[model samples]
Target: MLALSHYNSSASPLFPHFSNDSAGKLEARVTVEGVTDQPNFSPGQPTTGGVIVVILSMTLGIISNIVALIILANAYSLQRRRTKATFLLFASSLVVTDFIGHVIPGALVLRLYLSGGVHHEDSNSSDRMCQFLGGSMVFFGLCPLFMGCAMAAERCLGVTKPLLHSSLVTKTRTKICLCVIWLAALCVAMLPCFQLGSYTYQDPGTWCFIKVLSDTEEVDVAFVVLFSGLGLTSLAVALVCNTISGLTLVLARLRRKPGSHHSAKSHDIEMVVQLVGIMVTSCICWSPLLIFGLMTVIHSYTRSIGDDLLQYQTLMVMGVRLATWNQILDPWVYILLRRTVLRKIYLITKCQAGLRGNMLGRWEPTSFPSSEKNEVNQV
Candidate 1:
């Protein structure tokens, strides 16, 4: 098992962002046999193959997220649609979170590796940086989780209580809700910044993460249970809520009258389905990682499990990295489901091509009658 005390020592710079304890000193030592001494196996120690994967994932994620952002920003017609605007806004926020949570962090890890695996030292600046990065990661990570819940709820309202949805789900109201979601996530992420035991660098020269439990067996077990339990519980709630909402929308659509209005309703159903698909995909990708993360915390706390080192490391690595694919996948979701965005992109491309072609062509202006000539002819 990993020893909490071993990680807390001064020599390792895994978490250079937190301050040393009141002793104003750190003991630096390297242990070779135990979990504490084991390679962290996070982005810090990413193999050459892993680095290539990270680069590809981050590049794709950033580009896709940027496209999603542009779709939300420029497609005014899409914004005017009722539930679409709300969904688009949430989607945009999710993209932002994904960029921060995955791409930026991945880049930092790459930079660290390039610098000879030197860890950040615990200093005032490092502590602040840790607080910022950790806080942002938590905030963005949770945003999509909750926003999925919100999107689900909105679909439920639109289906089960169309009148109410029509009255309540306005652009301004959605903006307010989005703001609230962000604020709540920020609050959750920031809780550790103010407390000492709440945040720590994982090691002197490795990844920084939340300190779930100490090296003590009892504490480690409890810590694992806490984080795992919370993550599972949240996953359950989100899944249930989204499922119910999706069903409600489907049922409502079945009862609608046939016409252009019905066709529009069908489109709405498809959009909801796509959104639900995104939500479900996200849940699947994240849930296992959360469970494993919690388990690691528990196992580390107990110090009883020794042979599970490789398994634990694999789980941790998978949990952190796999969640990133959601960002890369989001742009495809928008393109597949959003007609307005597609139309606008097509029009813009066509206009650009036309202009270029005209510029390349040897062209002459067509002669037309002048205003004076036209007036004399008429007289």
Candidate 2:
């Protein structure tokens, strides 16, 4: 998501210009240019299909995130150990962020659709709303990525270096880390308000976000590049941490003696699995938006005015749509992919297989696999 700001009459052709009185009161007078000033470059209205899809998906996302939060709360209350509690803290924060990600910006989008979309000229109140939405797009967009990386790092330390993790990771430190992550994202989002870059209405006029223009000042281009770089770097850190944690868990399980037991091993595996889901989801959903923004910056010097501009706008719209899926799909990772739920799914599949074999008169009841037996004992 991007942001919008009040600009002068010399604003870019793609954005509106604002004026104010001597007393700093926003005047009623505002001007905006025609899209591209060419029939061939005019963008279409937000389609009914698109509006319906946003409404339904946003609704579902909000509900799912709420459900995930509830589950996390319940799980947190049942946990007596410090490490698990810390993880639940991080998970709860991520779910809350995802919920707000869908609610605040999603509500703004629905308002635009219901009101028949933004016009050539917007009122001061509307401009402020766009600014809020743009900042939200940046803040919420980065929070999940940052949180995923944090979670993965936490788990990697726990799985690969238990003694060190126990000594270093505490509830107080975890809470502070969450606050720092949010503050970092909020600071980046607010940088535009300090004139590093400006937000403007995106293609089709349904949303506003960080300006991704080729003709903008060098600072603005660098701002977009900075955002893209942060997102990609977060994803990279998460991928590396998740890989190390998973491999470490596998090797540990293989090395465990038949009668030996580490009660926390199962919990660590569960947390690692959840982190992998988050890493994969973030990578799949956000990579396009981040990569597209970077590509636009790299090619800004060679960008054309007519068809190329249209292509950029269209692709960005699609990229944002993909990015929104991250929030929607994130909660389900915790909801459906739990160790208990997965164990149930495995049992169901095994039962079905046994039934099929019995009907074919080749049934032979067998003992549970050693791994399955171990999981059952742990539970």
Candidate 3:
């Protein structure tokens, strides 16, 4: 949800000076005699219930991400037997970014709750913390989305130009691509501070993001062109690439007319599922916030302070929660939808249960999913 930010020294008294921006940062004013201070949309410690909920989310998200990482590591080790797919490095990088997106903000948001608005307790320190956390959240949150775009693009290259892809999409190149993803995310997140766009804390005070609304025509144009433009571009590219890749697998399977084996068809289905899961989950979780931001900017909605806006703020908080849930789900997407991670998880379970009899060798896989690389992407 698009939101605003501000800090009120005390709880909003009738008409509290706390106003929010499109980025969800609260804007506050300090009156020195007759002159009013600039707005500071710092976070406020709202209900502990919110903190408790996010803490649990953070816990689950962290655990799932760790499990995914372990599965990837095991799968990567096994991959030494064959030509390791460079695709896995992208997958691992995405998971890492998703983990950061969850943990870092989750902790900072928890502090905002536990400390009861410590950011407001001292403006100087809080300002510094806000700047850091605001940028950190934006960078981490957007990084994973773009990384998905990178994955989609890579898959497209692999399908359309296999020989070239095999030659060009090397381990070193994949690493470089990942670095570029992070660097790009960092640059976009910092643009708001330069007055090109806006970033701020929103209602409930746990999250900060790009401003969705513009106070003037000039800023409104900038917000639309940069903030919404970048988000939509990345999401559109990801969706298109994933859709094309999924269709290619399905068509390839369909084309295997006479000698089409059951396993081959199943592999096509699995690929479709994985790609669809990623695309759908991402859209469901993130599209609302971005779309709403665009609409608000176009309409030129004004950011207002006081208790009257609390209901609107409360409703909008749902968007933020959904986006956070995406972080928890990304790792699950890998484990549940991808063949390699799924097989690893299955083996790990058997191992922990002392079912060595089920094991073929020290680390050899006994599952059908892992028996053939032609069926699924490695890791």
lDDT of each: 0.55, 0.75, 0.60
What is the descending lDDT order?
Answer: 2, 3, 1
Better of 1 and 3 by lDDT: 3
> lDDT by residue for model 3 over 230-321, one digit each (tens)?
76678899888877877776566446544334443343344446656776787888777666555544444443322333434443465666
Superposed by TM-score, candidate 1 places the C-alpha of residue 321 at a distance from the truth, in angstroms, of 1.4
lDDT for 239 in candidate 3 is 85
Q: Can you give the TM-score per candidate against the true fold?
A: 0.68, 0.80, 0.72
Q: Which candidate is the best by TM-score?
A: 2
Per-model tally of clashing residue pairs: 17, 7, 25
Report how far off residue 229 is in candidate 2 (Å). 0.5
**Who wins the lDDT comparison?**
2
Candidate 1 lDDT by residue in tens digits, 186-291: 7766666544224334433333445532243443344345444544665676667667767775565455433213334544555576666777677776686677
Q: Which stretches of candidate 3 lie over 4 Å from their true place?
A: 1-45, 80-84, 118-126, 212-217, 260-272, 301-315, 340-379
- Cα lDDT of candidate 1 equals 0.55
